[model samples]
Target: MPYAATTGRSIAAVTLIAAAVLPLTGCHHGGGSRPGAPTRPSAAPRPPAPGDRTACTPEMLRFHARGVRHPAHRMLLTVTNYSDRPCDFAAQPYPLLRLGPGQRAVTPAIGPSDPGTVITLAPDATAYAAVTTAADGASGRGERISQFGVALAPHTAPGQVGLDSGPPVRVNPRTARVTYWQSRREAALKW
Candidate 1:
């Protein structure tokens, strides 16, 4: 019958159209446990790149100094990972001591430890460095350290920070020292 033939043609045309359009809509089979379950958009975070990640830039790292402790004479310099992806930092970070606002940069007499290893910082994780100064205030000793500035690398420009936000850490010109960067806060805090 002509009517039956027309219905067959219509069914064939619709099948062809669906076959062409389904793939365009990103429809795929077997995405779920079931053989034909529909797959929804994934809410998972993007996977981190395999192997070693990139070095931390100034933007990715945030500087934090938890209140200074007396007697111990050591300040924990926390570098928080603000980035979504894991990043690397050198084993030792050289500190550029600023005595006052707009004062000449004073490099610590002691440099970072040698054979620097790469430190991986996960998102929201922190790396720490121990800043040791004379238990007696480095103040009135001619060089009064007010702020600490750190760079991404030994050769990079110093990252800017506010010296007045927290208690100012004074470093004795002759005795100030900074430990190599450490993954664990406890390890870096050790004298």
Candidate 2:
């Protein structure tokens, strides 16, 4: 018994279609429901081209601080590039923020411990750091502070400047900490 020419062609077409569709069924886009599962990662921003890169200095950036809505002791810190060119926020993986004297104000890092890939901010762009202050009850309402100090990542002359807080904040030395500078505000707070 033999098949007609059109029937043979139809079978071949079906085979080809099945082969193409089967492979795609195993593939996924954006990790649909399981965000934690591995998927094609979003493209990361390209690094600054060679010599064009500059370190973001205190003068090049305008810093701001305010309390976070949740987690009562947290503060949201942001630095916006006020310069004419793009710059990298590079250093010990986080911003140097001090709210009190000596070692007492040191905000323990909650993210990368060492300097990693620098987060580049184009002119007018901004970066963020989430600072979790010490618990109030633990410190019996830690030192009341209305301002905090901010320093540039890499050592820069006039390394630090004091930025005013919208309201005085209390921080205890025991548990206060800060996250590494993140490209997004939500990312800074996520930690």
Report the error of model 1 at residue 159, Å. 1.7
Candidate with best lDDT: 2
Clashing pairs in 1: none
> Which digits, one per residue and each the tens of the lDDT, describe model 1 over residues 29-99?
53324337555667896676586457777798888764366436666677888988887764335445443
Superposed by TM-score, candidate 1 places the C-alpha of residue 164 at a distance from the truth, in angstroms, of: 7.3
Clashes of 2: 0
Per-residue lDDT tens digits for candidate 2, residues 86-190, read 888654457876667755445678855233668888899998888878755674656866676766653532244344546666776567888888888877777
- 26, model 2: CA deviation in Å? 73
Give model 1's TM-score versus the native structure.
Answer: 0.57
lDDT of 1: 0.63
Model 2 CA lDDT for position 71: 65
The Cα RMSD in angstroms, rounded to one decimal, for candidate 1 relative to the true structure is 6.8
Model 2 worst lDDT window (10 residues): 154-163
